[model samples]
Target: MASDVRFSDSRVGVSTPLDSLREVLGVPDLDTALLTHALTHRSYAYENGNIPNNERLEFLGDSVLGVVVTAALFRTHPDLPEGQLAKLRAAVVSAKALAEVAIELQLGQHLLLGRGEETTGGRRKASILSDTVEAIIGAIYLQFGIERASEVVHRVFDPFIARAAEMGAGLDWKTSLQEIAADHGLGVPRYVLEGTGPDHDKTFTAEVHLGGERLVVVGAGAL
Candidate 1:
């Protein structure tokens, strides 16, 4: 891997942005162009005589991200139904989630924005952050294969996965209602669940009662 491309060798500049990113990502032997391309936005690319941007890499990374998240979800949540698993996956791979990860990585600091974008606060934009995160993933995958890329993804998103798992559980109304009730010092919520109609077209209703509370919140769903 070290010999695969031209190493920086201090040719560009000392204490450069790439050096900072290399140290942050712990990939000392990373290909310069790969990382540079990952950091380059379309505006910067156009400004620099139409040099390549990260969009292509972002596209590739989207699929890589999906595979990584899907495999992790499948392994970790084997008991969850397919629908629930999909929801969890969607939450984790969402643009907002990726942008949050990018913020944690401080990737915005390394972006190569054009003058106009820089003036417009492009560094803090969620779209740019999320797209760059995916591009970085693509670059890592191309350089070190999926195993290393998966490691990077996991390292960057471990906290996010934990939060997403909690959010996924909250999708169950009973669980959320119970948690909310407990938070409000209302003890556990009691629910009287009932259903109507045939199996093919059934409507279910849940009447929830909190401790010492006269108000009842009714939730309904169809199966």
Candidate 2:
């Protein structure tokens, strides 16, 4: 899609019309009107006044996604204990994974955003994309049912699941990070400035640390 597909204010659209999304998602009968609502973000809704955001659908989709992910985990890991199942669930629903799926579906291009969000680049944000993805799943479940939502989820999550299985080990990065931070009695790690450059060009250095030991990562870009 073209970059010009900016959100109405700057949040809801940056892609071609959602007519194509239904085709990509394989839900031929999925109502386009609902999709308009699905794509509408609260920020955009506030500006329009006539339309509402996808929040309610997002709320519904959150639970639907949980159910779909849990059910898949249960069916796939019949032998694994609860701990393992929880790990798989986390892996499937992680912000990273959902954002990846949203990208795969090209969903980000269709988001509706308020001008503030658009000017600030809300389109590529993981939190917004992930929440919108979940909301879409919920909207599907409501319009159809678990069967449709599950089918779509399976199709959407297939690559992620296959990759995880190939890794041949349980995913525990987030979990391990928590324990390691706690063991060192670190309340939380934060970023502190570490450099400078010209007005249009700059750099950032962030440190994730526990006690006196810190891991610093530096990145450079333009505002």
Candidate 3:
């Protein structure tokens, strides 16, 4: 846990972005180039000499992180309701959480930014840090696989997740829906079961009605 991470290319055997990620995360087998793609911001790429951005890895990382956090939440809190578990997972995987992890890993210093992004203080931006960190996690999983990525993520988020577990249930989708209805100056929403699918594979369709008015949007899910 070094306090101040330097961006210089002087470290031994740390010539590439994956090397930088490995050095920073204390995990080997890191594809330095992929990690480079992870930390690379679109702005930096645009400003730099035709360097690629991190959007693709960011997308993959977002899903990977969601799965990781959801699985962790499910395993850690068996007694908690699903809604609460989802909320807890949401909090755990929030941008803020990712940004904190980025800071802990000293990721900003290692970013290969373009001169414009660097000048614009992109490294310190929370959005950039959060996205970059997720991208890195995605890249790490792709290179090192699920076992290593899970180990690394758990190693990073253990304490926070533990604290959240101690704190208890967090997700409440129904409540959120209710809140939306309430805020929209609508009366209690009436959920009408639109249709039921076949016996083998049942599907539930729900539509919310506001003030005796049917909602335009309908939701479908496996029962």
Top-TM-score candidate index: 1
What's the TM-score of each model vs. the native? 0.70, 0.67, 0.65
lDDT of 3 by residue, 26-101 (tens): 6755654566667777877777665668877788778887888789888878887676676787778778878888
Global Cα lDDT for candidate 2? 0.72
What lDDT is obtained when candidate 1 is compared to the true structure? 0.81
> In model 3, what is the error at residue 187, expressed in angstroms?
14
Point out where model 2 deviates above 4 Å.
1-16, 165-223
Instruction: After the best TM-score superposition of candidate 3, give how far the Cα of residue 177 lies from its true spot, in angstroms.
Output: 14
**Could you say which candidate leads in lDDT?**
1
lDDT of 2 at 8: 34
lDDT by residue for model 1 over 143-210, one digit each (tens)?
78899889888888767676777767655756556656766888887768899999899999978777
What's the candidate order when arranged by decreasing lDDT?
Answer: 1, 3, 2
For candidate 3, the per-residue lDDT at 26 reads 60
Q: Which lDDT values do the candidates have, in the order given?
A: 0.81, 0.72, 0.73
lDDT of 3 at 219: 87
For each candidate, C-alpha RMSD in Å? 10.6, 10.8, 13.8
Model 3 misplacement above 4 A: 1-21, 165-223
